[model samples]
Target: MLFDSGVRSGSDVAKAIALGATAVGIGRPYAHALAVGGTDGLVHYLRSVLAELDLLMAINGYPTIADIRRT
Candidate 1:
């Protein structure tokens, strides 16, 4: 499991996995997103965060989450 203070970027997610995290759990940010933007904002926040993770993985030569491990 990977833990951070509510990962805010895709690269952050990637790094967490690279450091050896089988699962990523997000918190705080979701609540903040909701507080700032409501349910719709939370959805958008999650999508963007996930998108960032995908992009970071693709660029780093990791085609899948399982392929990510410490460099």
Candidate 2:
């Protein structure tokens, strides 16, 4: 499977997936969130990223990851 690192935002994740990445490494964002506010910060950060990805998918008419890959 293909894995992409250096993902800093939801858009970056989407781009990687669209380009056929099977997984993404998001260590930096998680580390930053953890350092800033511990567990709660990490949760909030993850939620925000998922929300951004959901919004982008809706706006672009992509109902699933497979659809994103087709683009």
Candidate 3:
């Protein structure tokens, strides 16, 4: 399994997954969110990232992470 770090956005996560990353590190964004608005902010941030990833997958016709790797 490969772990990719330094991810800043949903797009970055998608790209890393597409490039065969088994997992990703997204600590920076979470840290920023926590510092800005606490737990709620972190929750919102995570939901936003997932939503963005879902949108990108739909736009690209990728039904799953495995499908993304085929691109």
Candidate 4:
């Protein structure tokens, strides 16, 4: 699937995976974070996005990102 742009949240990441994306790419958000908070901020943002994706998977009854395909 085509990602619109830089994903803003983990939920967005989950949605992309659930909808069948081969990978999630970061661009704009990283640039923005980098400009605003540098590497550390970018790291924090990326981690939060990952955590959110995991939580969404669990709450949606998916044990893993692959499960989202079946869901």
> Highest TM-score, which number?
2
lDDT of 2 at 45: 93
Model 4 pairs in collision: none
Error of 1 at 12 (Å): 1.0
Q: What lDDT is obtained when candidate 4 is compared to the true structure?
A: 0.79
What would the per-residue lDDT of candidate 1 be over residues 3-71, giving only the tens digit for each residue? 665567777777778878776667888888999999999999999999988888878788888788747
> What local lDDT does model 3 show for residue 28?
82
Instruction: Tell me the spans in candidate 2 whose CA falls farther than 4 Å from its real position.
Output: none
Per-residue alpha-carbon lDDT of candidate 4 for residues 1-71, written as tens digits (9 for 90 to 100): 66766578888777777788868777888888888889998888788878888888778788877887665
lDDT of model 3 at position 59 = 92
Q: Which digits, one per residue and each the tens of the lDDT, describe model 2 over residues 1-71?
A: 56557887788889989988888778888999999989999999998888988899999999998999888
Model 3 weakest lDDT span, ten residues long? 1-10
Q: Between which residue pairs do clashes occur in model 3? A: none
- Which residue pairs clash in candidate 2? none
> 16 in model 1: Cα distance from truth in Å?
1.1
- Error at 15, model 4, angstroms: 1.5
Per-model TM-score, in order, reads 0.81, 0.91, 0.90, 0.82
Better of 1 and 3 by TM-score: 3
